[model samples]
Target: MKKGGTAGTGATGRRGLLKRAAFGGVVAATGALAAPQVSRAQTVTWRFQSTWPARDIFHEYAADYVKRVNEMGGGRLRLELLPAGAVVPAFQLIDAVHAGTLDGGHGVSAYWFGRNKAFSLFGTAPPWFRDANNYLGWFHYGGGEALYNELITDILKLNVVGFQNGPMPTQPLGWFKNPIERVEQLRGLKFRTVGLATDLFNELGAAVVALPGGEIVPALERGVIDGAEFNNPSSDRALGFPDVAKVYMLQSFHQHTETFEILFNKPKFEALPAELKAILKYASESNSADMSWKLQDRYPKDLLEMTQRQGVRALTTPRPILEAQLQAWDRVVARLEGDTSSPAAGPFFKKVCDSQRDWCRRTGVFFLRNEAPSVLAFNHFFARG
Candidate 1:
């Protein structure tokens, strides 16, 4: 009876051992699964560069975007912001991002006009009959976003994803040794501009030089460029434009509805989990709204400072010159629309232009009919006695 009991106990012990080993195997399997989850929890950092120098207000705008992304990224993603020329020259930012040398960047689409003239259509040229904000309605509600994607993914074949924000007002004609009052003064003049505005000025017979923002003031001082325009009053003041030239040409058709572009390397951008991607997109949009509001405050204040303290002569571009600019645009459009033998706008440009015109033509009727005339209102409230 005792021997039989010992054999029974041995069998029970074997069963117990087997159960323990099986439990250990399940524990090991769970730990293996958990390892990947832990790996995913690690933070990802992106190297982002801006095409504006650190001192420029545009760079502050870039920083505003970075700050929003960092705060909203939920510790899983971080952006390390660098100013222009940190990773590559401002003009070469798209190329650097495309090659994966830089993870992302902030710049204007017009900066890449060397690659395709159609790029200018995204932001910088062919001023539609509305303000920059009104035109951005076309970019978002109309087919502009899709065409912009096609330009990047299909036509230009750049490995990038971009969003355009920061609707700038009508750019100034520029600063010259003397005020540019007549269309005739543009003849044989040396001027600086970018994007299709270069062509616009060229048709007016000015020798147009394309320089980045940081270089514009220096070029003007060195006579490398005779007269130049670099965005707005704040940026121009920061670039030391008032020190070099006193005449600040207030408004023009050139770059009348420009915006800033924020770019990401497509593969890198896609690899981000959907949450982080959403953060980036929403961050761009939020920054855009803030920029439009902030500029209203900053631009007016800076213009005041320049005019009141800095001996700057802020003059409206003459009516005749404005009319001439419109006529020049008509000719420029004809050439780009029909010119297939060269790298002018051609078919793809037509697609973009036609889309813009379609949106503008439909919306412009309502705008022209109902839009308030601000000049009369301003004169009533604020004009000097």
Candidate 2:
């Protein structure tokens, strides 16, 4: 009986040991399955800079883009935002990103037009489109993207990839100390602007000063410039333009439509995991749509404040001045497209210009036809009587 009891006790001990071993194997299997997830949780961080001041709405747009990218990345990718002059000046962002000093940057393509005239074709073209939306459609649906890549990568050979963000509204003619009652008034008026507009204004006989946004107010205060156009009403107000200049011209053909260029280092962008790269590109589209909506809401309010509270006089730019600008644009376009000064200039500029022109011809006709009734209805409904 004692021997049988000892044998039973040994049998029970063996069964318990086998059960614990089986549980251990299950735990090991679970841990093996979880190991890859732990590895994927590792984070990747990048530094970004913008050609906008810290308090500018453009900076807000940049920050909004960063926030969206981070949330979508699920903690795997992080982008840090720095305002203008953080690492380099506003116009040098493209070169800085190309050299890898910044992982990415936010600016307009026209800022680097000196590199190639084709940059203006993408940045801020003369008033070819009806509005910013029309230009954006050409960029996305038209062949603009391929030509843009050709200009940036193949021709210029910059090691960077760019996405177009925010489609800006028509920039004002500018703020002037005295009202411009005639096209001739523009002659010899020292003006501050950038991009192709500088050339256009110069053709119109203004002494164009290519000053950055931050310097415009100071230049105006110091009598260095007689008039200037920076961006929107809010930005112009914040930059203190209202204090120095009382006449705000409400329309212009100079930069009827433009968009922000968000650039990434080609190597860094290529090295990113496929999903992360998609996030970077798609975020621009999302942010651009959001920005347009915000602008629609904000610009009107700011314009009201500028006129009513700031003791500023707002006037529709005279018809002759508008007509004169269109004529100036004709000359500028002809010069850019006909110049064989740079081997890449004429053909590359024509490629982009042709694409935009073709799109404008077809799409613009449709817009003009469809928009006429809307304008009529709007006028009838909002008649000032």
Candidate 3:
């Protein structure tokens, strides 16, 4: 029910701007990679390894992105996408890219939070940064992007090419074997989750495990984990989570929009002719838009099909479970704020929450009532166009 896409593109009504303004002239001005004619003669090929599994929507996005780039470049920029473990482990994409072993890589920006907790603030957090629009606004228009580039690129010195990959658009809470009745239900539960969810889950006395998508189903099926949360209905169902765990709870507060990032080695990016630089960015913007659109269309249908056709148990997280999670989230976030050791993620989270709360107070409550009509109208508009 929420929106997703490239920053400044999709449901936001900025497609025209992206096409005509964002990089229209930047590419031509960068004389090095010049017209597609010259680059096409040489056929510059690059390797792009991704952290996502082949079936993941985000992975689909990456594949589509490579195809589009190849087409648009007219045979100049050919990219070979290697799945996780092709070159480096799934979780080590940023490191691989930073090391310049590959031309570029696709991964979630916050997964590198271990390098600097501040990266977590850019991704997602519980009881905060709920809306996709708010997150985009903060990153692109607010000081968030400047702060991020400053820290990650300027300070940490990693070769970074960043773009927002997903909104996972209001994900399901998780699949629970038993209904969560209260805050205590979370206690001692081993959950496969990540980011701020891990901290929040910890506060509720749950142990959090960070597992790749491929591993989640096996872990849950084999009883290595009590419960788990993945992407939207489409992705989870595709991966067979519904078959393994029938009780699918909705509205996970932990990851409102799990942003996927594409990073390349800085030196590699810099070494490219300015024209290739512009081309890559333009290609990224287009691919990102396409990726988000697929989710916008598929998620709703998948959720409906899962319940109606597959007999999967799909329902919202109980109010009590959500309420309890909120309490624990607040406490944990507050404690994080008070801790000076590394409050980067915490304070940035507070700002994002403040912004979202203020926006919701002004417009979101009323907006929700009109969403059905809006979705219908918006869908028709895009379909016809």
Q: Can you give the TM-score per candidate against the true fold?
A: 0.89, 0.92, 0.79
Q: Would you list the clashing residue pairs of candidate 3? A: 159-266
Number of the top lDDT candidate: 1
Which scores better on lDDT, 2 or 3?
2
**Model 1 alpha-carbon miss at residue 30, Å:** 16
Give me the overall lDDT of model 1: 0.90
Per-residue CA lDDT of model 1 for 289-359, tens digit only, reads 99999999999999999999999999999999998998999999889988787664788888888989988
Error of 1 at 281 (Å): 0.8
lDDT of 3 by residue, 137-195 (tens): 55666566676677677657777666655444766778878766566777888898866
Candidate 1 stretches with Cα past 4 Å from truth are 1-41
Off by over 4 Å in 2: 1-41
Instruction: Give the per-residue lDDT digits (tens) of candidate 2, residues 246-365.
Output: 999998889899899999999999999999999999999999999999988888998899999999999999888999999989988888888877764686787788889999899988
Candidate 3 local accuracy as lDDT? 0.72
Ranking by TM-score: 2, 1, 3
Judged by lDDT against the true structure, how good is candidate 2?
0.88
Sliding window of 10 residues with minimal summed lDDT for model 2: 342-351
